[model samples]
Target: MFCTCLCLVLAVSGGVATTTAPSLADKHNALGFRVFAHLASADRNLVFSPHGLSAVLSMAQLGAAGTTDEAMKRVMGFSLRERGASRQHRRMRRQLRAEEALRTAGAVAVERTMSVEKAYRRALSRAFGSHPLQVDFGRPERAAEVLNAWVADHTAGAVPELLAPGSLSDETRLVLLDALHFRGLWKVPFDPRLTHRGLFRGANGSATPVAMMTLTGRFNYGEFSTAGGEDYDVVELPYRGDTLSMFLASPFEADTPLSALAADLSGRGTPEWTSRLGSVRRQLSVPRFAVDSELRLKTALTDAGLANIFNVATADFSRIAAHERLCVSDVLQTVKFEVDERGTEGAAATAAITYSRMAVEELTLDGPFLFFVQHKPTGAILFMGQFNHPT
Candidate 1:
């Protein structure tokens, strides 16, 4: 009965098109590396893992679902390239499988680009499987209304509204929408009334008092003072199932050279740090911002490692397409993010991002802010961006 119920919801709400492929485990690893590198760059200074990659990828695919394999690789690959991973390393090379191998036999390509609502429904089906979730994709204007309503429902009003309408392209051939609502009793919940304005410095040496979320719990952490003359703290916050964890790192001092810090990174020391779980007070202050971005994913994918996929002369979507002549005309992406104590309630609605984080300076906003979004199934960055503005 549960399986039947789940499939019905998946079919109705999720726009997941049926394909011959079983599950995409190999692609997950390739995608993971992309996300990790992009967020960990010296300029952006963010950290992400495979789980963050999945969240963002699922959200993107939720809105824009045609030929996701290539776009997914580019987003993930760009992310990995940004962090300092070698572009031609053997490990990276292995992820580059022959394009012909990715196709399913006798697959007939469909030209109907899935709508964001359809893509989002597909994502929900993938995440919740058969669990019921509300999803809809129609006219561009209706997108905002449907998304906002979904957010309100899932977040339990934490995110009262999601889209402001026309947030998507009126002429957009497709749209993907993912509405995720999570309600968890914090291991140590913060007293809402106890919230106080605290100073958060930025790269420009300015300071603003922001509300900081507070909690305490036993967490897995890695504390280190790098030889390259930087000291930072890496804290891992585990979600309920233990299948996912959020890794947050902040420099010990505001002025610790970030570029050098990133240069000294070696995945080698990370495993050793896994044994350092302990209880401690956590002061978390995440800012709230909304951003929208539109991108030509087809080009971006070519720049990464999937050039063959777009090369009409060498393209191989044959598993889905009838002739080798057709190539991806356009790959569009749109995303939205909102963070608060209730544990991240927004989706990457469109293809862009508007992010605000604690400044690099402890007391002033004269340094940089860096972060990443990773996937747990395979560590990767679905999106990576940074801002140097003081405002």
Candidate 2:
């Protein structure tokens, strides 16, 4: 179940055209960074989809009124009041759907007892590209099964069980879910023969052996410093289509906390990092890792200054339904992301090579670092996380 409020926004904003608003992308980036900062805790493997969270929350903002709406806008960094903002969101959603490497799905499961307004349903249908589902939350067991099944089906079995049994109850008025499954092959696949177990320094001063995928190729690279004067490196690894790429950043000094880099990225948009990058030949060694994370966004959202939406009484959803007092009960997001030596079947022949004479600079993520799976054209961040320890 995706955020029902987000669904409402989608429905309301579906008609907005993409070309009409360029700031929409900026709004997406700002909101993505905000969510990342809130969800990213120091010293652990963290993974979540900023786009998924923001997309759903945008919907919620559309149906929100009074202070609830204000809180969402502040946290999300985008307001429905902006001219053509709704159209821009709708266009962005369509663009995401068109990407081959990314699979994103959102849904709102409303309790059968509640009466949904027809206008709300119409807007939801437009935003999600599907109609809302009615389920009997009175039977928590059955509700869990149904919602979990929907998540599994949408994510292509990557996330089998998103909502555990008894996660829902008779009192559950709404359930919002956003599931993202991404498997993108690199444009230049890492040589499998070069992969070997290497020691990864953990955040807490421990080291563990991990499978590291290595490749030497021309990549967009840059060197930047944090506000505190710490140096770091940024590298871009393009996926098969070039439309999606993973930007990896880590501090040069081993003892530097990954949090510093994360804070910088959140404060300064990714475009700054990308702008500093230019094509350079280097040897990159990233750990072969997979992270499946389940995030309850209530705390993160609240911390990001969107507190009133969760309040039972203070929250308002008058735009969605007239008489029923509706407030967001839970906003959940599940993300499954994996990085490996996989790319297009015959991409080896098309791989670009430059400057074989220079010694390849090694960019090994031997410790904690931040990574973002981003859409190149629009600069929308599909997923972002910290690889503190990849087991």
Candidate 3:
């Protein structure tokens, strides 16, 4: 497969187009960082799919009105209230699915006895590409089994069970889920013969030996700094088909925290600097690693300015099931990711900008760093994470 892209964004404000406001893609990416910033604990290897999670939330927003809809619009940046917003979302989804190596899925499971509004179901099917699955949530185990099976099928078993035992109960009026799986061969694969053991510096400054992958090639490299003036470096590694790429970044100074860079990147979209990257040949040493994490995002979302949906009284699902009482119980996202000599395989999270290094740049990630998996065509951050502790 051959992949190629560098997407751009047209900013908008209120109901008018503006050059100063954050674009739709930028807002979503920013939300990813805001959520990750909240979920981030002390030096934990965390990964979650911001793209997937947003899809589920957007689905929920379709059924909202009044204050509920307004909040979702403000927090997420785009809404059904905006002209052509749904069409834009659908177009973005189609562009992402065009690449065969990436798999994505979304679903809304409703209680077997309650009826879902046709308009809301149609909205999910049209905009998010998800169909409502009617299941008996009263039997929690059976409901979980059914939902998990569908998720496993979509993820190719990488995530067999997204919801563990007792995650659901008889009161589960609705369930929203998203599954993303991607396996991409590197455009320039790292040779295992050159791979060797090296010491990795943990977040706490402790060192441990890990398998390190080394590659010296010309890549889209850039040196940048946070608003607070902390320096960092970024390297772009494309998958076989240029459709997707992994952009890895880390602070240049050992004392500088990774969180600073993450926060800056969240404020800037990929296009802001991707076009400015200079092709440079650098000797790169990065740890081959994998991480699996389950993120409880209810508190994070509540903190991010969209809390009404989680509260039954304040929430509005009138567009979904007008006669029934429906409010979100919780939001959960599970992720599994891996990197090796051949390529990148992962599912799911975000968390900066520019300056440069002259001469032969030998960049090595021996400490905590952050990475982003981007859909180059749309400039959307599909997955992101902060690797404080190697797994």
Candidate 4:
């Protein structure tokens, strides 16, 4: 089926005039960076994009995008508060409070900015048109071609021919397509020759052999013991100015029933810990796999207090010309990740920016995984989540 062409109508009427360039906050940029980072790790075989989300927020702040100085403060404040709301409910509450404060003070002007972002997204849609997912035994080969083409096109061919369109179904179209895609390589590559198998403890306390990629280099890192009955390790992988981290934790060997540790770790709060680095070289192994899943991010985002966007009746995006109604149509994110001895590499692309790269090697995690994407300059948790399974 042909996708709709959500093109931009440049023809303008005299009443509503559009502004040239509006001020934008570094905070929004930083926040966008972090969100993209975490999605990159979740899977290495698909594209994880963050355009739609970033555009909406940026657009809302167009005219009154806070000054860089003020933006930095707000950005920092968000990060500090995030440390406090480790749980979903608390996190949502915290964001709502911040957004309300910005609105109450008449400081954050994002409406105009959002308008521009929306138009840009529409242009992207038309430039690289996409087809809805469809599957049928009779057209299995064609289905694979369709899926592979979308993935390659979105990722700019970095992750070539990754998905088998044949695996999709007409019902797949029903699933929300919101996705975040990233692609990059490690600052330090692991020796592919040194790769070896090591034991990885599963959620059920069973041990299995996993291919671990190893590396030896000075890395920014943190350490801590969680009240959740686990010892934690935080390693930072810095990019051109952005940095993302992986937090690995597991029940202290002496801790009681392993299941009990899992329960404790699930609670949310500031991830209590310490930071440091040392001269260390070790063998590491990780599974080579890709994850492709569709999420109804609308619910999660709405549950996080962004109901106005989903509820067209309440959405306040009137700044885009005289149009009185605008709400998020849908949020589609797809992420692909892969890791081996040479180093970790993956990509996360969304319909928003089209594509991004996040690659790292010489990476290893021997415990529970908790990762966060942060604007290296501002410690904002654009996105945060934990992975307990190998998808």
Candidate 5:
């Protein structure tokens, strides 16, 4: 799991149609990828689900007010201010759940001592579909055990533990727990018989032998460039439901850093890139990988334009409860994923990823690259990552 954003901002409602998809999906995507670019560095295998993070944060945003509210609004670029916003969010949930292949669960755990407003509680249930939980933050370890138990139960033990030892403290007032599990089969499942050993070259020309899965089929594919003129290729591997798909991008030049491609993906170019992709036949090679990450996101979120939510002096959450002036203590996340010949199977991954493409053939991700698991119907990115040093 990989992501960080301080808080969410809810807008006062407008008349937008609830039948339409939430425009905020794009903003949610933006928040995720922006954080990815901020965290991208040498030799890290990052995995996160931005859609899940946004959903959890929206629960908290319903309780924000004043400067804290305004700050997040300016940063997230999406708001539930309009009367229709809530409807839109619900539509997204319904649209996402239309596929039984994917399962997601969320809950908001608030400090037991704080008296959260009933209105805020209702908003969480109505707008975000979250299960409300209250625990004793003063007893961080026991609180963690409760949260971990819920996560493990929902994720089938894939994430038996999320909160690290001492990651939570007495000062903590709120924690959001989200878990998503997806076992997607390729539209055309990869042939296990074709899986063979191949070398995945890494930074500085280091190569690790890996099991490479191969497929030659028609797919939505394209090639595009970054603002800095770094060229890259992309291919879409649709799941059985067609509502979700996996998109992969890699630099055409082996020497280029995955970060260059990551920057463009999290920016305005990403949506455009995906829109331009057309069906083409190609021979594709991708490594079998399993990645699980636990991250503390305060630094990454601050660097990614979410700096105000963690500042005690400036942070505001009065709309939530009145026990004390509550402020963010930490943003913790964990992500786990696996990919192989049976098709991609794993649970959890998120955000800004602007991308584009024409057509390409004979593509192989035998080196460092990027991957996104996207909800096609909503255009919301469920997972985002920079694949380097995968195991």
Candidate 6:
């Protein structure tokens, strides 16, 4: 009678993790960039939560069996079946929950025909702080309302509608939903007065007017060459909490496509940039934009070689429910991200003074660029996308 909703929200303030495992974090970032590449576009703005999607899928993997489990592990880069994987996940979730800036909540709703496993519920509780609830999926409209309400409540209204009417039906056996809302303020706020309409060079070689934010300050900056030997620039903008930051990258040549940069990102991941970044004073210009993306990941997952879980005949979720021949009917993720002049509260009061006498290097994102929101210490990519045209 119940439809399940797995909701996750990551809000970065000004704190960083000190205990994150490098190897584990690398695997996470690698998987995140791979997902971004699968969803990449050169002409459109894109944003999605890799961490959110990973969390939901990982939770589902707890109940998987045989090749279904193997395929997930192969694509996700980590296996829940591995020794101490669940404990490590539990520790990581606890650390995230301890941060005042990060908010996460997950729920599993069960139908009467399916029986929820105690061990699976316990794992969910320990790893995601999730609780189980019963809802009537037979009444699809009512199930939709319940799940949507839960998402809205957990995300503090950032995501109001996760499921549209008829997204669920009597035939629906399982639904996995994840939502992440992040509104991070810059460490040093951009002067609102300096935000003016500037021409953004489009991927098609056309230009459009956009509100560009400008600031001159010290930031983590680096320049690197892609596998194709093309040069590009990367700049890190730390949110109020130093723990989370957004890294922006753009090619040096105007004619160079953003896809090239995306390919490099997916191939090498963030360590390539993070290892090279150094504190530098620069005049940074970034567009003020908001992106909302909704994705049904079945296609993306399948394309990434995770097709077995979606196949009802071959699928095995005996760990969660042995009663019904349940397969993942739908896996959905929604994300809302906004960047503006304001950062976390008290950032202005605590903003550091950068007194530089030399000419500052300018880094402007007036064209298509790729970005990733990262958990600093752990190097886990929470979100990754391309900003081609502001939405």
lDDT of 1 by residue, 1-391 (tens): 0000000001111111223331243344445434334333333323222322333343333222235445544554332222222222223223311211111010011113422233334334444232222233335456546545554554345444434454443323322233332222223434566555656655445575556554444444455666665776655544444433445555667666454434333332222333454444444443332223333344444455545433334433232222213233333333333334544322332222210022222211123433333223333233333322223
> All models: lDDT?
0.35, 0.67, 0.71, 0.34, 0.69, 0.66
TM-scores for all candidates: the values are: 0.50, 0.85, 0.89, 0.49, 0.87, 0.86
Off by over 4 Å in 3: 1-23, 347-359
Candidate maximizing TM-score: 3
lDDT of 6 by residue, 1-391 (tens): 0011244211111111225454665776777677677777767777766676677777777777778778888888887657877777767665655555666555666654556778877766766566767777778789778877877676666555766776666654444444333446677889999998999887877788999999998988877787788878888888777988888888888777777887877776567658778898888999987666666666777788877766666667667766555565445665556677885211000000000012248778898888777777666677777877755
* Ranking of all predicted structures according to TM-score, beginning with the best and ending with the worst: 3, 5, 6, 2, 1, 4
Measured on C-alpha atoms, candidate 3 has an lDDT of 0.71
Least accurate 10 contiguous residues by lDDT in model 5: 8-17
Q: Considering lDDT, which of the candidate structures 3 and 6 is the better prediction for this target?
A: 3
Error of 2 at 176 (Å): 3.8
Q: How high is the lDDT of residue 61 in model 1?
A: 31
Q: 77-123 in candidate 4: lDDT tens per residue?
A: 23211322224323332332243111100011112211333543332
- lDDT rank, highest first? 3, 5, 2, 6, 1, 4
Q: What is the lDDT of residue 157 in candidate 3?
A: 65
Cα shift from native, residue 273, model 4 (Å): 7.3
How good is model 5 by TM-score?
0.87
Runs in model 5 deviating more than 4 A are 1-22, 348-361
What's model 4's lDDT at 127?
A: 23
TM-score of 2: 0.85
Which candidate, 2 or 5, has the higher TM-score? Answer: 5
Judge candidate 3 at residue 342 and give its lDDT. Answer: 93
